[model samples]
Target: MVLPRSSSLKAFLVGAGLCGALLAQSAAQAAESSVWQDVQKAGVLRCGAAVAAPYVMRDAKTGDYSGYFVDLCRDFGEKVLKVKVSFVDTNWDNLVAGLQSNKWDLAMALNQTPERALAVAFTVPATDYQVSLLVNKDNPKLAEVKDDISALDKPDLTFAVMSGTAQDKAISSVIHSGKIMRLPGMDEARLAVMSKRADVLVDASDTNHLFALANPGWTREILPKPALAKQGVSFGVRRDISPADLEVLNIYLRQKRDTGDIQQLVDKASIEANAAK
Candidate 1:
């Protein structure tokens, strides 16, 4: 009922060869899991961007992207990864989605929050910022809200916030008495308060300062207390990225922080803001 010994030997060799092939395929698949390696192989780093001044910006004349965060990404490409850089523009609400969808390799200037951490991984903090408020200068009611940020939380008061942003969540947490106007962009949120369409804009302290510098007629207030949170800003990568890749980003940030590279940027932003004043 059995084949000859030679035929049996041939069958055994075939099964061993099949096992080796399967093992090789499994190893190859494992190697592909390291996203950093893939980036290296591609020789390009795609950065996801949602413009916010001092972080990301474009020159009107030259039409080039130049900001602290943009420059930092370029440094990472040249010094850390040895890759070329390209940018993909997105809105504040969709930056994370772009990274998760593989449209880009890194998400720039993301504020690390628990809700966001659930969807993406963050590098070590690049900077710290406070959640604050900006109110119309012409409003006679400003004095009442001056002593207490939460005083603006009244039925008649309205808050403007960029939709789907952390600031929106922050405002809703504490200002339950006021109505919120969700806007599509940061500029719109600031304008809502500036034009008196809304009473105040819940935003970052630095952002409000920049707005005040640009429009001397407008006034801004730093929230004596944050509604829900303050944010530590960082670059984001997909949750599935390799630990090695994360380490590379962290190391670069640490170097910048230790050398006062970040402080220099803060100083420059301050100078520019003051000049606008």
Candidate 2:
């Protein structure tokens, strides 16, 4: 009660600082809670889509989007969040960066990895993923290898992989001797193998399976005996997203997985992708 003027002034300043800090914390909380609400207000949920077969595919002539993840994005936007859905064309390398820059609300078909987790949040997996090799059936180099991918790790062999993808990293790590031709997209990598520019096309197992099915006579899928980069493929969101906002996505994914809708979408997309081929 008898404190000096300086003491009182110091106390007042301390109180003001605490109040300011509290106010800033409240504002951050409000911003986090409004994440989904912001999308609803915008009236459109923009999904960052990159073409990867059986997961995401874009039609060339019509410019239409398909695949299970695309369906999931549409379902979440229109049915769950009550907003229109739009696809923002991106490639694997840009998926995380686009999410970080707010270029899109979600990045489709992103494999959950420790490196990626540091930059973004992820919902429950929509499906599993593993890397595989798709080689021309007649490639004499692979004839003696069977499932041993290491056998193909020779300087004479060329491996084609989409740059910045999990498969690219996986193959690059193991195939020191082989030439890795990093392409811009899955289609380009596939083209490299089909056109004989590369001896092996490295991609997701599901994608390679579909590709081999579509070209049974020309392509053969090899699931490396030890596997490569096996992980859950999930939708990538901003790291700042609130737990509640992320739970909404997890609930939707759980429902889809339980009802077997996810598998159905996968089958449908595979059929369509093959038909187009």
Candidate 3:
């Protein structure tokens, strides 16, 4: 039997609403996957960058940016995406937030941490990261410490670390007795050690290695036996990025890694950073 006129009209309206909602959801998904299309349309891929020496660096006078991650960003944008690459300066604390707010398309040189994984997506890592300590060559207090970082956990020794960095978190969790001098950037943290305001400078192993190379007689680096916060350093993108878009980045990284181009970039950046010191 056919339904009454009133019932048929109500059913039609409900079905129409459901269909409209489904269409809207599909459109949203399409828009999310269209990030590549959007970049192509704009003709530029903006990368959010924070200076971290070999990973990311900025020129003092010219404000030009360079580093392994910077090179990767340029290569991906220009070679793979066929777009111009632009760097948007940011700091460690804002890298995730900038990506969330659409301030940049990619956040460069971010360590893939579980805390950050909650808010963003990461592409394949360009490099691995581990923490190390930089200390004065004549610091007798650390003479017996050897490879154990825990020996530096003393009230008299102050550790300088870049605020909101992975190194800061790693050291803070274990060194309760030592005073922590949290500074805003790498330069400030290095200065704290140089001026004797802090006894140890905690930073990336690669960075500390370069620093020791630059200041041969003054500083040295200690790589702990049990590495601290060892993780992959990757590019951060919006969590909603489509698998297709994400794959494009992963493929590019794999190609560079297989071709040994990533290592070359690392060496070049390390030399530049050491010479600039």
Off by over 4 Å in 2: 2-28, 31-33
Q: Show model 1 residue runs off by greater than 4 Å.
A: 1-32, 60-63, 226-228, 269-277
lDDT value, candidate 2, whole model: 0.91
lDDT minimum window of 10 residues, candidate 3: 29-38
Model 2, 88-166: lDDT tens digits are 9998888899999999999999999998999999999999999998888788877787788778899999999999998
Q: Clashes in model 3: which pairs? A: none
TM-score of 1: 0.83
Per-candidate TM vs. native? 0.83, 0.90, 0.90
Minimum summed lDDT over a 10-residue window in model 1 is located at: 268-277
Ranking 1 against 2 by TM-score, winner:
2
Per-residue CA lDDT of candidate 3, range 69-152, in tens?
999999999988899999998899898899999999999998989989999999988899999998997988877777787778
Query: lDDT per prediction?
Result: 0.80, 0.91, 0.91
Clashing pairs in 2: none
Model 1 per-residue lDDT at 27? 88
Global local distance difference test of model 1: 0.80
